[model samples]
Target: MCIGVFKKENFEIVNNPKDAEIIIINTCGFIESAKEEAINCILEMAELKQTANCKYLIAMGCLVQRYKDDLIKALPEVDLFLSIDEYDNLWEKVAKLIKVEIKSKNTLDYMDRIISTGNATAYLKIAEGCSNRCTYCAIPYIRGPFVSRKMEDILEEAKKLASSRN
Candidate 1:
C-alpha cells in the first residue's frame, strides 16, 4: 500500500548515502540489533544531509512506532517521523513534508496519481493492527491487533494490480 503511492523511480533506493537525495529509512525496532541498525542508518543519512545536500530525511516503520519521542529528539536532522500505525497515511505525511497537496479522497486514488516502483511489484496489506498482548512487543499495544481483510478484498486488489501492470 505504501510502496504503491510514490513515484518510486524518482527516488533511488540505496543503502549507501553517497548517491541519494531523500532518504526514507524504514527502520526496525524489534530487537537490540535492529535498533542499532536503525540508529546507524539515521546517522549515515544525517551525515549525507549535512555534506551531500540531501533535502529530506524521513524515518518510518517499526522503529518510529517503538521509539517515537526518542527518535524525534535524537535525530533532530530527520525531517519527518512516521509511526507504524501511520502506514495508511504515508501519502498525506509525505505530501505535508514536501509541501505539495496531492488531491485524493482515498489512498488508492492517491496511488493512481502517484507512480509506484513503476515496476511489476506491489505490496498488498491483508490486514492492519495486531491484537496480541506480548509484553516485549509493542505492535499489539500500538496497533490494537489484526482484523483480517476479507478474502474477496485481497483477491480483488491483487487482481487489479496484476492486471493493470500486465
Candidate 2:
C-alpha cells in the first residue's frame, strides 16, 4: 500500500536504499527477531545521512504504531515516526518535507506500482492490519482489526490485473 501510493504520486523507488533521498521503512514487528531486524535496518538506513544523499528517514508499520514512544527515544536519528493510523496524512507530511505539492491518491486499493518482478505476478494485500490476539502478540493493538476490502473492489482489482497480464 505504501509503495503503491508513493509510486502513484511520482515518488521514485530506488533499487538500493542507499541511493534513496527519502527512505520509508515498512516494518514488521511480529516476532522478537523481526523487531530487532527492523530496528537494525532502520539504524543502517539512518547512516546514509552521513555519507549518502539520504535526507528523510520515515519509520512506520507495526513497530511504529505499537511502540512509537520507545522508538522515538531510542532512535533520535530517525526524522519521523509514522504509525499506521497516520497513513491518510502521509502525502501531506512527505510533501511538506520534500517541499512538493501532494499528488498521490490516498486510497489504498488504487495499487499503481512499479513492478520490479518483471512478470505478471503482483501481491494483493486483501486486508490491512490483523486482529489476532496471542499471549505475547502485539499485532491486534498495533495494527488494529483485520479489515478486509469490499468484495466488489477485490473482484475489480483481480479482473484488472488478469486483463493486464493477458
Candidate 3:
C-alpha cells in the first residue's frame, strides 16, 4: 500500500538503503527479540544518513506504535515516526516531509497497492488487530481491537489483486 502511494507520487523506490533518499521501515515489536532486532535495524539505517544518500529516515509499524515516545527520545536520528493507526494519513505525512502537494485525499485505496512479492501470489488483508487479548500475546495491545473489513471491500480488493496479475 505504501509502495503504491510512493509510486503514484513519482517517488523512485530503491532496493538498497544506501541509495535511498528516504528510508521507511515497517517494524515488528511482538517480542523481546523482535524489539531488539527492530532497534538494531533502525540504528543501522539511521547511520546511512551520514554515510550514504539517505536524508529522511522514517520508521513505522508495531515497534513505533508501541514505543513511539521512547524511540523518539532514544533515536534522534529518525526524522519521522509513525504508528499503525496513522496509516490513514500516511501519504499526507509523507507528502509533508517530501514537500509535495497531495493530489488526492483518499490515498490509501487498497486497489493502488503494489505487490512486492512475486507474481505467483499476493497478500490480501481481510482484517486487522485481534480481540482475544490472550495473556501471552501483545496483539490486542500493539494492534488494538479487532476489526474486520466489510465483505464487499474484501471482495473488491480480491478482484483488484486477481486482475492485477493479468
Candidate 4:
C-alpha cells in the first residue's frame, strides 16, 4: 500500500519551493474534495510563484486538463496547462521555462539520461482523451475522442526508460 515507494521524486519536495524557477503541480480532479485540494495547492503555489521568483507554474494532471478553460479563467497564475497526453513532452516545456536547449530527436532520448528515483520504475502512459458521454461530465468534451498512441512508440519509450533508470 506504500505507493510513495513507487513514485518518482520529480517535484521539489521541500518546505520552500519558491527557490525553484519552475513548479509543476500534478493535481486531482476526480471528486469535489480532490478538486478543492488541487485548487488550494495551485493557489498556494501561485502565491509562492509571486514572491519566490518562481517564473513558471506549470499545471498538469487531471484538474486543469479536464477543466481547461474554466481552470484557466479561475487561475491566471498557471503558465501552462496539460494533461496526461502532454506528459510525453513535459521536459520540453520545463526546459523552455529554464531556457535550456533539449536538443534531441526524441524527448525520450533526453529523458533516458535524466536520473529517475527508481531503477525499476517508469511512468508508462498508454493513451489519452476520452469519449464517454456523461451529461454531468466534461472529460469527453475537454479531451475530445480517445487517441491511442502507437504501440511501437510507447514500447520504444519504455525500452529507453527501462534501459536508462527507474
Candidate 5:
C-alpha cells in the first residue's frame, strides 16, 4: 500500500531503485532471518544514495519500529526511518526532504500501483503487522497489532489492479 499511498501524493514509482529519487523499503521483521534480510536489504538499497538516483533513503515497517534506536545508530546512510505507525505521514516527510509541493493532501484514494515484481505478478499489502501473539515471532511487538483495511479500499485497489492489465 506504500505505492498506493505515495502515488496519491503524485510521487513516481520507478522500476529500479537506482532510477528513483526516493527509495523506500517497506520491510518485515518477523523472524531473525527476516530481520537479517531486512538489514541486508537496507544496506543494499542504501548504496543507491551514492551510485544511483536515490536521494531520500527511507526505511519503513517492522524493523524501523522495532529497532529504531539501534538502526539509527547502526545505519547512518538511512536518511530517515518511519515506523509502521508513521506511514500515514510518509508523503509529508518526503515532500519536505525532496522540497516538493504536495498536489493533493489527505486523499487516500490512490489505486494506481507500479508493478515491481517480475512478470505480471504483484504484491498488494492489504494490512500491516500482526496482532497474534506467536511466541516465536516478533511481528506483534515490532509491527504492532494487525488491523484489516477498510473493505471499500481493498475492493477499489483490486479494481485498479485488474484494470492495469487492460
Candidate 6:
C-alpha cells in the first residue's frame, strides 16, 4: 500500500538504495533482533547520502511507530521518521519534504499498486493490526487495534490482483 503511494506520485522505484534519491525503509519491531536489524539497515542506508545519490532517508513502519522519538534523536542522519499511523496523509508529508505539489488525490488505492513480488503472484492485504492484545505481544501497541478492510474493498482488490496476473 505504501509503495503504491510512491508509484502514484511518480517516484522512481530503484532496486539499489545507493541509486535512490529518496529512500524509504519499512521496518519490523516485533522483537529485539528485528529492531536492531531495522536500526542497522537505516544506518546503512543513511550512508548513501554521503556516498551515493541518496538525498532523503525515510524510516517508517512498526519500528518507527513504536520508537519514533527515540529513533529520531538517535538517527540524526535520517531525514524523516514516519509511523504507520502517518500513512493516511503520506503524500502530503512527502510532498512537503521534497518540495513538490501533491499530484495524486487518492494515493492509497490498492489497485494502483506496483506488484514487486512478480507477475506469478501478488499479496493481498485484507486487514491491519491485531485486535487480540496478547500480554507479550506488541502488535496492538505498534499497529494499534485491528481494523478489517470492508469486504467489498477486499474483494475488489482481489479481483484486481487476479486480473492483473492473467
Writing each residue's lDDT as its tens digit, candidate 4 over 48-163 gives 88788688888878787678789888888888887756666766665666676666523333223444346667577677667778889766665678888888878887787777
Q: How displaced is residue 71 in candidate 5, in Å?
A: 1.1
Give RMSD to native, each candidate: 4.2, 2.4, 1.5, 6.6, 2.9, 1.4
**TM-score of candidate 5 versus the correct structure, residues matched by position:** 0.78
The residue-by-residue lDDT of candidate 1 on 1-166, one tens digit each, is 4444654324444545666667788788777898899999898888888888578889988888888998888789999999977766777888888887667733533234332456677667678677777777766765667888888878877777777774
**Each model's lDDT:** 0.73, 0.78, 0.89, 0.68, 0.76, 0.86
Q: Model 1, clash count?
A: 3
How many clashes in each structure? 3, 0, 0, 2, 1, 0
Query: Best by lDDT, which number?
Result: 3
Those runs of model 4 whose alpha carbons end farther than 4 Å from true positions after fitting are 1-16, 79-117, 134-138
What is the Cα-based TM-score of model 1?
0.72
Considering summed lDDT, which 10 consecutive residues are worst modelled in model 3? 100-109
For candidate 6, report its TM-score. 0.93
Provide the global lDDT of candidate 6 against the true structure: 0.86
lDDT of 5 by residue, 72-102 (tens): 9999999889886776677787777778887
TM value for model 4? 0.59
| lDDT for position 132 in model 2 | 73
Model 1 residue 85 lDDT score = 72
Query: TM-score per candidate, in order?
Result: 0.72, 0.85, 0.92, 0.59, 0.78, 0.93
CA deviation > 4 Å runs, candidate 2: 103-107, 115-120, 130-132
Candidate 3 ranges beyond 4 A from true positions: none
Cα lDDT for residue 34, model 3? 93
Better of 2 and 6 by lDDT: 6
